[model samples]
Target: MGRLFWKFFFFIWLAQLTTIAAVSTTFWLEHRAQEERLAQLGRNPPPSPELRPDGRPFPPGRFLRPGGPPRPGFPFVPVVPLVATLLASLIFAALLAWYFSKPIRNLRSAFEAVVNGDLAVRLGPVMGKRSDELADLGRNFDRMASHLSTLIDGQRRLLHDVSHELRSPLARLQAAIGLARQQPEKLESSLGRIERESERMDKLVGELLTLSRLEAGVMGAMDETISMDELVSDVVADARFEAEYIGRTVQYSGRGEALVKGNAELLHRALENVVRNALRHTPEGGMVALEVHLDASGNDVRFAVLDQGPGVPEKELNAIFEPFMRGESSQYNDGHGLGLAIARRVVEAHGGRIRAANRAGGGLCVEIVLPATCG
Candidate 1:
């Protein structure tokens, strides 16, 4: 019933009417010409009426008209057939117009709903079993809407988590200031507490900014070819000092240079995060093992970190890489839980894959794979 429908109807009806008129006119003109020919023959008497040896004009009418009886004053008039065709064309044109415009109307309605902030509106079910370009368009729209809904939901969740994470340090900073005001004698301790809380806040904010940049895919001029084995060795060396300080141990095993093309800083940070995360979960006196090797295909470098800790649940293995997701174990609840998330994002940004699984021998193993530069 919209303008489009009317346009289609008008054009289709006009075309059908034009065709009907042309066909009708052709048939009518031909019939009129035939009638004229017959009348002319009657006037001329067919060049001397046939005479069969004293025939006397051959019974008056038989000589004038041969074959069957006359057509009885042109019974095949175009008026009746033209009228029937008009009616049929009107019906068919309306139907064809509706068929083309109905899906368009539905699409318009769906667009309006989306503009009104309704992301859940779907056109697939309404389209039934139709398999056409319009139906494909509807499916694409559904996918886009679904992706937008998920992104918006994730942004909202990230905002909430950031606020929650910052609140604790902020509250502690305020409390430390108040304590310093109340007890001038313990000003030094209060100031130290404030400094610690401020550092924690700064670290959290820096991690958040890095996570945002990674999520936005903001890689700037990363044209460096980094050796994976060297990076892992550097991370393991740094982790060894920390592990020794905490009465734990860091063991490293690697082979081959395993060259990859990316930003060295980001790749190093990702590897560090994964290693430190394992070290944090690992118990004192336990060993965190880091291993680097080429995968079976020899097209990518794989870094595996195995830790002796309470493994994540089967369901949470995938979720652990999500921002601010922490394990349920008491030992796993210390940090803000962005380490693995940031690591995952960084690896993914560089066209890599990262995953974690529970070790059969009672621990967790995290693996990071990056595309290797071909020789």
Candidate 2:
């Protein structure tokens, strides 16, 4: 009933009508030629009819018009059959047009709904079981809509979480200010509390900005060929200083020189985050192991961190990489829970993957794999 339907209908109908008209013309012309030949033969009668061997009269010509039974009609077209064919073609053309345009109409309507902010609108159910290009198109539209819905939902949730996380520190800062006003003797301690809260807020904001840039795919270019061995050694050295401060230790091992191409700063932060996270979870006096090596295939560099800590639940393994997702344990309740998330984003931006698995001997193992470069 739309313009597309009408266009399809008109073109299809015109094609059928033209074909019928051409065939009808050809039959009419052939009939006229036959009549002319018959009339010519009638003008010069075939000498007298030829006689048969048994003395019975025989038609001199196969089509002996003058002697044969009379011809039926003049214009020579079977009007009934021709009219029936035209009607049938019209019906078939209309049906075919409707069949093709119906799915398209559904697609248009679904797109309009999406434009109107209805991201949940879909076309798969409306498309039926058609096994054609249009059906494939409908499936693609459904996938796109689903992706957009997920992204928008994630953005809303991230905003809410950000607001919630900021509120806590802001409230703490206000309380610290109030306490300082009430107790001049404790002003120094109160100011230290405010300073600590301010620093935490600053760190949180910085991580958030980094995550946003990574999600937007605008974190500078990955054009440097970084030495993984050196990077791991540097991170381990820094982690050890902190680990020893808390009666914990970080042990590092390297197989060989593994090279990768990426932004060194981001990669360094990612490695440091993973290492520090393990350190934080491991019980004091327990050692966190950080190892770097090339995989068996030799095409990828792997960084594995193992800690003697309570492993994450099976269901929460993947969720731990989401921003502000912390473990239920009191130890995990300290930080803002953005380190692993930021690490994940940086690793993924550099064409790498990160995963966590429960260690066999009652611990958690975090691994990052990056494509190795020859440089």
Candidate 3:
């Protein structure tokens, strides 16, 4: 900021200096010419008034020396052009200053709006040609504003979808419990299914709640910063045991500390889903690998979960992040699509990115990257 201040100040000073110099040079030249003419005429005093070529008489002071006869009783010679030139320079300086300051003023205003949380505010409709860097700046601001608006809109939609899904299951659970009293035998199995459904809904609701809090950056109770090795290792150990018991393998490696600042519980949940997502899709003979490495692109820690399962179509790569957008289902998969959505939200909260893609050897790869703190 200090640098910018001096840069503009110097520019304005230069402009004013140039204008003054040009005006002073013009005045000096005109004055020198007038003085030479006056000096030549004074050597002869114009031959006397009768020697004048015009029939009409000339002004009394027309034949006087350039600066008047250095006598005590001559009218003062007016510095009209010099004063006019100075005035002109003042006008030019004022106009140049205004032309240069207007764009800067607009930029400051837009920056203030951004600081005030009006991410949608943009420097549009700026009165200028679209050929200069300022035009590019205006366009860039507009683009940034547009992207922020889209992200906000996406979040709002995700919230609405989550709320709507949770409400329906909750209402059904309430109704099912009420009916369980009237038909004990018949409602037993129904209640069991309802109980299971209610549990699933409860889990889904909890995951969504965590995702929301992460995205909003609200502090959840019992949340604290923990070591990356501890978190990832715990999840892998627990999941690996379960996979082994289920006749599958959960191979993993997270050597070298990958530091991140976040809620341990929420991050655990996020990581759990990513690992489970791969495990669920992977075949019995197939293996799921949870690998942690430094993300070169983001200069952050990356925790990637790769699965050797049937890959998704290319068209569904990004769409899979939407809430409740589970990829095409199979009889073997009772998939609820909130896993990737929650993963994405949690990672983004830490200024990170997550993505999914098909692997070369016919499988799916999900990568989670969290921003790294420079040590």
Candidate 4:
């Protein structure tokens, strides 16, 4: 039997049982007292009453019954009616149990399906249009399942992309090794190719590790107060050095000092990745600008990086933050396509949001918003 059925059955049964026991006990006690009184009457001799003036009995009908007084015993308790009532109660309890347990059973089944990897399972239709806690639970379960399914799908896609990415470099590395073995005289040149490929592989692995850690929330404890302005300046300075070498320009502009509490290393890396990405796309002699300022309320600090290169397509603005997701313009570049993804993870870990949008005039603008430390 279902839980509701048993619960109702037992409850109703116990109540009826208690009522019957009480009634039976009271009847038995009254019977026993009456029996004791009869025995005492049998042992005692009755004293004759004084004759009335008219020689008539004072209480004429009092002694008219056959035994001295009718012996007291159990009272009639309508056993048939009591039994019928109990049976009815039992039936009603069963019905109530079934009614309450039906929805719960449906929810359990849906949960089981989800546990078995059936993400499409939902309980909304099963729950029907009832306004109760059970119905609310069904709705919440569907929402949770939908979210979990999305995350799982994203992870699967990420794995596929990662495998595809790893294969290309591996093939090149193997070919370079084969060439070195075949041409011993040009081993040095072949080894140079091998070294470059190895370095590329190492960088890719390191970035993957970093991304994993960020996503897993494995960063070390953050206890440092970071000056956002200074951090941005440092990243911009490094980008500027590289930009100057390539005939491009990097500039930093800020209003007030923006301070926040977080891991300085992670914040720096996040900013550096964004700046470097912009520098990579910005054409030679173009400018990549970095701006930092606090919001009007001073509760949040905003960092904006704008590049003078071809911006991403309007439709793919959000896709760029996903792992291995590259825009049309970036597809032809020599990047590993994980820079923006890592930057996003880092910023999110620090309780911030990063977004990219196309600048009005030209190029792409990336923004980072972090909660500022209160003065």
Candidate 5:
């Protein structure tokens, strides 16, 4: 038998044994008292009852003739009834034990399966229809398992992508080095190519480190009050300078002072990444707009970045926030694909949400919503 069976057997058996022992002790003590009383009365205690003429012992007592009080002695205890009651109690305890142990056994088995690397293992259906705490435990286990499975899978994919992205730049750098060795006259040009690739790799690695820290919930410090208006203005001014190089313009429009409590450096980086991403996608002569506003209830600060470029597919809007995920339009863009992902993690660390959607006429709109501070 399993652990449940042994546990139930021992506990139930002990309880039944206690009950039988108490009953037996009570009966035995009464019998001993009666024996003591008889001994005290001596050998010829009392005369035998008188017999009737018909030889029926005067029928003991009759309705018409009242009989004397019953003799002071131990009452008879029925061994058969006692044995029957004990037997019935044992059976009931065994059934009760099984009822409780069955669910616990199933949970243990499910936990074992999870330990054995079966992330898909669930206990809901196995538990059937039950409205107890054990059932809730089972459901929670399934949810935890599901979440772990997702995280593991995502990590695997990220590793694969990182390796793939690194290979292309490394290969180009190697080829450039080979050319420089073959042609000494073109060494300067080859060195330029090598430097660019090295810088690209450096940027990729830096972004990856930032993403990892954000994912690990390291948001620096939150001891400062950030001005949302100034933050957006700084990001837009910097992006606009960069956008001008590609014939694109960055515009900023909003009203009122929106303040929040968070790390100023992190908030600035998060908003800057978003604004720069919009500027990168907007085509030459196109416009990228940044808007900061408070919701109607004034409880939330909202920042929206709208880009006049080919928006992503509807189904992929949410997926773009995942690490190293890029849309079709972004395939030709020169980016490490971790900007939005890092932005998302930073926002989440500050108890905020970021989402992307296609604008009405065209282009894409990315929105960030944060809880506003009272002061």
Candidate 6:
């Protein structure tokens, strides 16, 4: 990069030098042309003595006299505009070159940062609005850096989540089988517990695989159209049934025909995860309400599932959508913490966004927004 910078800077300097040299040569040629014109007029020695054979133009005027000796040929360069314009052009070129190279310098420093392992390094303001090819290159570099950072972060999260989640199941299995060998009476219960833990691990792995497939553009082949309103309504109905089975109720309010394109099973799973997550936190008789809003153009729809339960903290709002990020409130929850993460992945696969927030009325609100298909 430094070599490139020096090469680039020298190229500009050499260009300016070449231009100035050309102008100066033109100036000198024009000067010679004027002198040649004088010669052609037979005035090469300039007007000769109108008066004396003396070296003085007139009666040798004293140096202190008011009327001086023939005022020496206006003491000027041969080609005034050429000389002035050449100097002016050189100065203008130098200044313009410096102004243009400022961004390249910033870009050089930013490259140094990236070389030194700083993924966050970005070009300075000089590069942002430049109307040249370099500006586009700088923007593209920033975008590449951004995506690399995101991919690295995602990999880190994946490693951490997978490691932690696997430990529990492996440990449980080892313990269960170990104990089953010694005590026959506890064998069945221990085996059952082992099976349960193994199922949870399988579920987590499945969700991770689904996330990977979604990122790999797997949904590009799936064909399913779902109504956003009915989608939410069905998930809420299931949650309500489960809640009532456990002595709780879910309140649902929504419009109809909020249509979208997506894999119905995946969409159902995303909504079910959200509704079930809300119901899991609330107590008996607590209410979970569903709201569906269609865009005025009906080209989009939003589903908001709100629950009257202890909402997650503000700082955890964004993190909760990330895989394995169990909020402070969910520290004791029994399930693996992939529900919201999977919900986000599914929604995003269909070109949408999902966000969690604290409702004003003391609860959590998970909003899913999806693009709708036009009739």
Question: Which candidate leads the pack in lDDT?
Answer: 2
Query: Residue-wise lDDT of candidate 4 within 259-337, one digit each (tens)?
Result: 9998999888888988988988888789999889999999999999999988999889999898887777563457788
- Error (Å) of candidate 2 at residue 291 is 1.6
Which one wins by lDDT: 2 or 3? 2
Q: How do the residues 1-375 of candidate 5 rate in per-residue lDDT, one tens digit apiece?
A: 577777887798788889888988988797777566656656332255545457775444211123332333335668898889878887888787877788888888888988998888888998899888988988998899999999999999999989988998999999999999999999999999999999999999999999998888776888678899988888878898899887999888997899999988888989998988888788889999988899999999999999998888998999989988887656445787899999999889888999999998889999999999976
Root-mean-square deviation per candidate: 4.6, 3.7, 8.4, 6.7, 4.2, 6.0
Q: Give the Å shift of residue 183 in candidate 6.
A: 0.6
lDDT by candidate, in order shown? 0.85, 0.89, 0.73, 0.84, 0.85, 0.76
Candidate 6 C-alpha error for residue 138, in Å: 6.5
| Candidate No. with top TM-score | 2
Q: Which clashing pairs does model 1 show?
A: none
Q: Give stretches of model 5 more than 4 Å off.
A: 16-68, 71-74, 78-81, 328-333
For candidate 6, the 10 contiguous residues with the lowest summed lDDT are 62-71
Off by over 4 Å in 4: 1-4, 12-92
Please give the distance, in angstroms, between residue 152's alpha carbon in candidate 3 and its true position after superposition: 4.7
lDDT of 2 by residue, 127-182 (tens): 88998999999999999999999999888988998999999999999999999999
Candidate no. 3 TM-score: 0.62
Candidate with better lDDT, 3 vs 4: 4
Tens-place lDDT digits, model 3, residues 1-375:
344454565676677668767767777677667657756766444444442355665456533434333222233344685577657766665565665666667777888897788886767777366466776777787798888878988878877777777777788777777778767876877678698887888788676676666667684653354577789999998888878876678888876776677677778878998888888888887799889877656368888888888878898889888777776643344655788788777777666789998999988899887776544
* Better candidate by lDDT, 3 or 6: 6
Residue ranges of candidate 2 with Cα displaced over 4 Å = 29-73, 328-330
Worst 10 residues of 5 by lDDT: 61-70
The window of 10 residues in a row where model 1 has the poorest summed lDDT is 62-71
- lDDT of predicted model 2: 0.89
**Residue 12 CA error for candidate 6 (Å)?**
3.5
Model 6 over residues 38-128: C-alpha lDDT tens digits? Answer: 5566532324433445555453321212322232242234477657765776666566666666677777778788788788976535475
